[model samples]
Target: MQRNASKPWLGALSALAMLSATAAAAQDKITIGLLEDVSGDIALMGAPKLNGTLLAVEEINNSGGIMGRQIEIKHLDPQMDNARYQEFARRLIKRDKVDVLIGGITSASREAIRPIVNRSDVFYFYTNQYEGGVCDASMVSTGAVPEQQFSTLIPWMVEKFGKKVYIIAADYNFGQLSAVWTRDILGKLGGEVIGEEFIPLGVSQFGQTIQNIQKAKPDWIMTLNVGAAQDSFFEQAAAAKLDIPMGSSIKIMLGFEHKRFAPPALANMHAVANWFEEVDTPAATDFKKRWRAKFPDEKYINDMGYNAYVTVYMYKMLVEAAQSTAKEDLRKVIATGEACIEAPEGRICIDPKSQHTSHHMRLISVDDKHNVSVTKDFGLIEPYWLGEVGCDLTQHDPKEQYDPNNLPKK
Candidate 1:
């Protein structure tokens, strides 16, 4: 084919258009402040989350940028320290003046930074699943709530195992609230909780706790532990040979505990989660493949990472639709919205009332080979806890977090 002289002129015009767009993007960029731990305590979970967040940012920028403005991300590692989290949050808000903020693997870290971000009127997103029932106008949670998780999990566990149960959790807001949810759900379901314990954060020795569990001898055990140190519970429980059917709503498959621990530790353990790498779906499988391709050294992409990825995309949609990063404007857009994004788990919807993502929770069983199997699929469940508690951000901003005890009984 012979090229015409006019074709050269057309190419020059296209290059000029590209240059002009680049110059425009350079002049106007959206800043996103990221707070996550790359070392210490929650690093195992935080590192993966950071990776997922960066991946989503990369995808967004590549796909014509966010509203024609390139996204600028300032990632800070708090090293799993609450004081550091507060400091970094202040820096991001006061110094960087980021338009949007996303981070905090632990509920403690989130609470530490939440007030600062909310007071500063910054759009904040927390991607990790926790105890639930956080009513705040300045935040959007992309993780599954207690109602979505335990509503399916408790019933299944009770039916599979017996009614009697033992509960163990980390001593913090997330664990405390989760314990309450467990007791409340069991009561409503006509089941009994035989025992319960709260282990301090980073407490490894579960000798007394194990003895208590064995003595109580409930039908099963449910854990809400957090951090790498808490992983010892699995090994210790297995060592004690207290092999009753065990389950966890908060952190079983998170951080790939099944893979990290030996077969005996997690084998035959049951869990209910928002997302699992073993999910057999086109979207999930493709996400795993892409994750592997990007981070060849990493072996697992758990719910935390998956949720972080979804949160970023969720923010992108809200920001583009709102066409502004101002916190109030973003909240206003979310108030009248039902945003949906096809996540690795499935399609998650952001509820207008709750400002939390509705997820498709799965009943997962781990085998001796560290393989995960989906026992039951609880199709897309909403964060009804907030709505039940009469949390309406549109009408008025409560500027507070709600717990189950404060709300009506289920």
Candidate 2:
């Protein structure tokens, strides 16, 4: 009986030792929670974003990792479900305890998980071009906003196309808010939105919408369609021989619609954004070469993917600058406006006041051959709307995204 009791005690000791070792190993890694759509309505764009994130972690780890600790990524596909975003965000913060949370392809998804991150004090990085007006210290937005996108495109559209415009966008916060910005810019430019329609993300058909555009006979159509629902509009427009010029904020760059759809469909499309795959720079070229080397079988990398890639590196830079992974220290470092990185797009820096990034923007026009050309470069445009509307995260973080409708007039 004594011998058997001693054997059980020995087994318990072995189990305790294993548990201790596991805990020690866990301390040797920094984890990032990547919440993206891998297989759903948004996967066409989200997959590239996921690849960018995974690639960054691999590179960081291969180069001896962050602070000599390896990067561990907990990538959960939300399948384009907002509810899943909330659920996974909770899981990441409470259960897995990720060091940082990165990924939210759309403004809807970002807003869905924003509150959860704010409450938990988990550092979040929203790596996609959005409708702007987010003011939060708990998170940093590292993508183009309406100001960066429209400042050049709208003026050029009005100059080349005409003063009359038709608006078509995905029916979400992103689309709705972006439309507001469009009207604001166009109104100032002595242009007008003659007709408009908000299409659901699942609805790819555009027969009636195209007819409305034809009836309106606007100078240009502002096409902000996203995801799988995008291709059909271009195809249907071509079949109808609409032949009108199109001006947009979120067009070919993210979805690569210019590449996906056949010629002339996107020939008249002009997109203004922060990053496009065709953007040529020494930094961008090297980045593409490395991305190709890793993802040889990968399709086109869009703006969202490039933003994710830059943000991951930015996070590493901030963490190292703070010399700690604590959220408090990171916030202090970011508030200094030193949380900047030389990205594929160029030197992108966070505005110490608004917690929004200033982007290197471009106006890219697609040709009949589906080739993209940089028509103009709007170098390092600051996010004007949020700061213009009293968002100063350094002193006071409202921890909320303000609606354009409710904002104070400039």
Candidate 3:
């Protein structure tokens, strides 16, 4: 059979039409640049975070999406590398043209990409518990910060555990700064840090560190260990049978270390958290059930995962309230209104002035069988660190993370 030249020309025209249609369809959807560390030292938390974001995006798309526009997420794994975070942030902004940005497990990673988003005028959501005091018009931190966690945790530890404690934190901006907050809060609570240690990520063995803690023999241990390798500290402590009561700001909540490690590993482990899989609220139970139905293999829904899930819905609320996804409009809604959401963990409200979420915190512990239960409830703590220190995003966009070292004195 002989093909006609006219037919060949018709096929080329059809292909061109299809390309144009695809581009138009993409333009109709709102884009989200999702950066997560699905691999490397922080994968334990990052992989779960990506899963939660995907789940929320799917639900949002199914429910008519944000402002009638479907969400199209452009995901990139930074692998816990700061350089990769910067490169990926730039690519997502310049190439993908995403309407919003979300991710960053560590404070270092947040600082790495925050400037890029600020310069590009992109809205950003950081959904992990961190050292507080980030003030920026282009961002909202929905995670529990030191003000929410340490304020309640330190006092509880001092009241129950003892007045003397040992702190083992990771050697990074988050861990180091969290350590500082712990010291400050504990000191205020009339407690003292008898021994302090900072461990680098990917250090599994804790022989020397365990010896140090044993020698110090404080009332209890405050474990700020982060990442997968550092999780081994729980196992080592168990093996050595360091039966001393321990408290933390992260231990069981962010990493779900109790569920991952063997029984008795986290026997005496206690931590302050905004939410956990076992929170038992009707919303929390439904969320856990649905997540398990979708991801049958997932072990536990940690705090980071819940934060990612809630932050996505928070973005939806902001878009619908503002009637637009433009950065300026969203900023206006956040700046003008006390934005609140009924998440799995009760009510979470945005502190408009500080650009952080007020969290419902609790002190929880795990038994030898790895069962977690709330020991005490500290209801709805507003993120007060930035506001108390004079960093108000509504008044000015400083574009800086205020820590103990660089805080402005009122």
Query: What are the per-residue Cα lDDT tens digits for candidate 2 across 155-272?
Result: 9999998999999998899889889888988999889999989988889888999999999999999988876865589999998999999988888888888888878889878999
Count of steric clashes across candidates, in order? 0, 0, 0
What 10-residue stretch in candidate 1 is worst by lDDT?
A: 401-410
Ranking 1 against 3 by TM-score, winner: 3
Better of 1 and 2 by lDDT: 2
TM-score, per-candidate, Cα-based: 0.91, 0.95, 0.93
Select the stronger candidate by TM-score from 1 and 2: 2
TM-score of 3: 0.93
User: How many clashing residue pairs, candidate 3?
Assistant: 0
Cα displacement (Å) at residue 106, model 2: 1.9
Candidate 1 lDDT by residue in tens digits, 1-410: 24746488877888999989976664598888999888997778778888888888888889877888778889999998899999999999998778889988888888898889777878899998888877787889988788888888888999999899999988988888888989999999899989988888989889999999989989988878877898798899888887888778765557788878887788767888888778878888888888888888776787888888888888888878788777777776777765777777777778878788888888898877777898888888888878877887676567677775776333
Clashes of 2: 0
lDDT of 3 by residue, 1-410 (tens): 24656488877888999989988987689898999998987787887899999999999899899878899889999998999999999999898888899999988999988988888878999999888888888889999998888888888778887999899999998889888888888888888999999998889999999989889999988888888888899899889978888888888888888778889999977888998888998888899988998888887788998899899999999989998888888878887756888888888788877889988888898888999999999998999878888987778888877887788656
Against the reference, the lDDT scores of all candidates come to 0.83, 0.86, 0.87
Compare candidates 2 and 3 on TM-score and give the better one: 2
In terms of lDDT, the poorest run of 10 residues in model 2 is 401-410
* Candidate that scores best on TM-score: 2
